[model samples]
Target: MGARVTIVFAALAAIHTLTPTAQAADAFATPAVTINRADWRAAMDQLRSELNAAPEVAADFALTARRRSVAADDPRQRPALVQLNGVTSAIFTGIGRSPVPVLLPFDTTAYLAARRKGAIDPQALPRHQADFQTDLFDAGPSGYDAVFSLPTEATSGLPSRVFARPVEIQITGSVLTYDVADPAGGKGESVKALAAQYPDLRRFIREGYVRYAFTRFGVPYVVSIQCLDSAPRPRRLACREASPIAERFLKALRIAGGQPRRLPPEIAPAAIERPPAPDPDFTYRPAGDIVVNSGARGQSGRADLTAYSQIRYPLDAPAYVHSQSFGRRRASDKFDQPWSQYPWRDNFCEARSFNVGQCASGFGHQGQDIRPGACPVRRDGPEACDPWRQRVLAVRDGVVIRSTRQQAVTVQVNTGTEHIRFRYMHMNPSALDADGLLNGRSLREGQPIGVVSNYLDHPNGTTRHLHFDVQLFTRDGWIWVNPYMTLIAAYERLIGGRGHEIGTEMVSSSVAAPAITGTLPPAAGPQADAVHAPN
Candidate 1:
């Protein structure tokens, strides 16, 4: 908003570029606090023993994210269904290990009877595993469990981030919590009533999924039964039926994570900066600039005023911010059409595969497509580019949460009071698998994750460009948001200066963007006439 504030943000972004490889690696170098594994393990063991003494509620009540063999030796301190202490609660003290212990007041008899009434065997309910972010969690037969947002730096021991946290946190479902990706929340009488029980609870439906979010012990937890279309009547398995059960879980929820100290309130990201239109030739489209099936236009869309994360630029080399598919074909747009050149356009909500709630139409592209620095010279006396040569960097210090073989690599960053996720696409999944970028991996900010390459379902399914987006933690869990402003800020810091906003009158739809002066990276110039590789 102010020149002074812009300068401050620019300075911070500079830090990302200036020094990159420092995280837990710089532990001894700096006076930063670190936690030892022995100490962490000891603290957890103590917590487990305390719970065993308090109330050893034992029941075979179903609904869990973990697979348990009926014949396998039960790891609980007490035998299954033994009623160790009047059976007023249930303790999921993780089998085969005691890393995380959960104690909750549950009516074992009533739960069992209800399952039987519905003609379902409570004890025999299948343990439907939770899928990666691509699909929903199989919430078992009862459709509920004291789910935990695991894979966090505290819960999982990622080599780089394991020792980074000053204190460890306990999440329910223990090791099984690893499969549970984003915190999903949903609605109904059950959800509303459950929300009522917690103070400062935020409730909403994200992309048809209802959610309830609240903070406790300085960390945020979300509960969702994954229901949708709560119209004239509450959808089955929606929050209504879950209300009573959820209320019970919250009432019995213990701050078992053993968070030693309270966390401060979340600090909202900075607001959008509106610097004066510094250059007429430096044109760009505004947010929610919904492109028709076949209509290309110059500047005129209004700017969106949402705040975005100020993270590191994703690419190491220079890149052009443009659309890979603006070559809609109806206009005979060539593979190397100048349409892919500068005067960077905002394609966050462009028509593409996938759904985005941030888009005005509620469904479209979930990220911004960027082409890395100009293609290198070819051996055949021409300048052709290879996307695989460009390096893709980790935007921040975070844990890799994407499943094995999953195409999109999502890194979850849980620092301070913010829980954010950054996603990178187009890189081949097979390469990632070989590189050990699998789930629970730790990544430092600015680390070279992999080289950019075009690999959708098959090789080069789309153009050679990086489809990047940002997802913020909200009442409805993790959902996609536009990264336009964030990228602009990051680019400003990347190239060491600010970019001017060009007005509509200065642009023409019939022609591609003309080259201009600024801090923009290579390939920002007109590429309409340049011969390039096949998509």
Candidate 2:
């Protein structure tokens, strides 16, 4: 028992001796991942506080960190809350170009409401999400108006505004103006299909651009890159090289969800105007009915049928719809006779140096031709029409997208319901430049653009008339669709009366067209502004 007691004491002594060492080891040793959770939590709280203070700063928190409780936020922070809670975020140009792709989270309810105004069928929209604003640099890249990136909203009560924007990207050796639209409306293929087709993207879109369309989170997205092969070799970038760049952009897209919110009034459904149906009194020839004879354009005849829009009569005064051909007439005379008399003709499919996908032949004049109102008093000069008197007018409320040193000025109407561009041609380029009718100019409906003149490539290259045409946002970029229907619709509205369509045989034969006449709206008063487009 004494020996046992001695052993126990010795054991206890050994334990007592090791206690200090073990305590020292415990002090040295620590968890493999002993997270500074306190510090981490503090940082998160700091970020949330900053975001709440200035919702726009949420863009600063992109990958850093990021929400869904607007009701819980302070009332003043409501807009900022949404703006901050993924409800409001801005993509700021980083110190340099950001390596990250942008995620433009949309309010699903607001998106649907905008489409409803555009006459989009509610059932046709994707169930989880309606139509998505395309990621086209043209779309998300391109702003509908020159004003700002997203639709402008100035609601009286809101302290802040919600907006979506893409992260800016840099592409060397390629020239892209950053316009937007791909799968603009309707739907597109799945992301998998787009990936499969990415290798040969040119086959998918018109204009030979590398275009990939895919859907994510039930939203359709399109990304297009032009070969710019036409660009210098050192600067040239093709689809093969551009596909990866575009793919990266696609990868960057993420959905930022916010609770249901109302859209701005301008694009809201209540403000939308439905396009009119074909009026029985409004008569026009079937679209694509090219006089079928380009050589005999001097004696051209064929009234054209048209499409919709809230548009002003293109002409400031009542005008004659006739052939104002660029081609020389059979005789010394410009196209062998009176250029203004008409049963209305269609030149949208007339022969041209370029290709027009809308034409049956895939190559023709891109637009319709309309002459000045007075044909009887033909004047001799660079233009046959009275440039000082007769004029062309803005067809819709829009911005001037194209005003070149060449011969055309294109005004673009880019609202939720309309993505159409109106081109005015034949007026002298010098004159347009003089009037400050250049890109990014603002215009209202019925605003005087320029006078109808005969300036084609040069002065008097074509007959004195407005070579008016239009283009719509399509998968093929800005494909020139036949504006015959749109023009007819605008004219009928302008005249405040109905027009009956006439037959080609009636104009081709000895019978003269029953002069369809209507006076211009009193509001279409003369303005010094004149505009110009392609021949």
- Superposed by TM-score, candidate 1 places the C-alpha of residue 466 at a distance from the truth, in angstroms, of 0.9
Could you estimate the TM-score for every candidate?
A: 0.53, 0.51
Model 1: residue 130 alpha-carbon error in angstroms: 12
| Number of the predicted model whose TM-score against the real structure is largest | 1
Off by over 4 Å in 2: 1-286, 293-306, 326-339, 375-389, 403-406, 509-534
lDDT at position 402, candidate 1: 49
Q: What tens digits encode model 1's per-residue C-alpha lDDT throughout 1-535?
A: 1111111122111111111112231011101111111123333343344344424221342112234554455434233222222232223321112222223233333334444356544343221101101111111110112332212222221222211112111122211111111333333233455554466666554543445556432223555433323321211233233333334335545322222122122222233333433423333555444233311123222244343455788985356566555433224323345565556777665543233555555544567888776554533323434434667899888767544555678776654323467988878777887898965677998998877777755675665678888875443455676677677666656666556645445665543333211121111000111111112
TM-score of 1: 0.53
lDDT of each: 0.43, 0.41
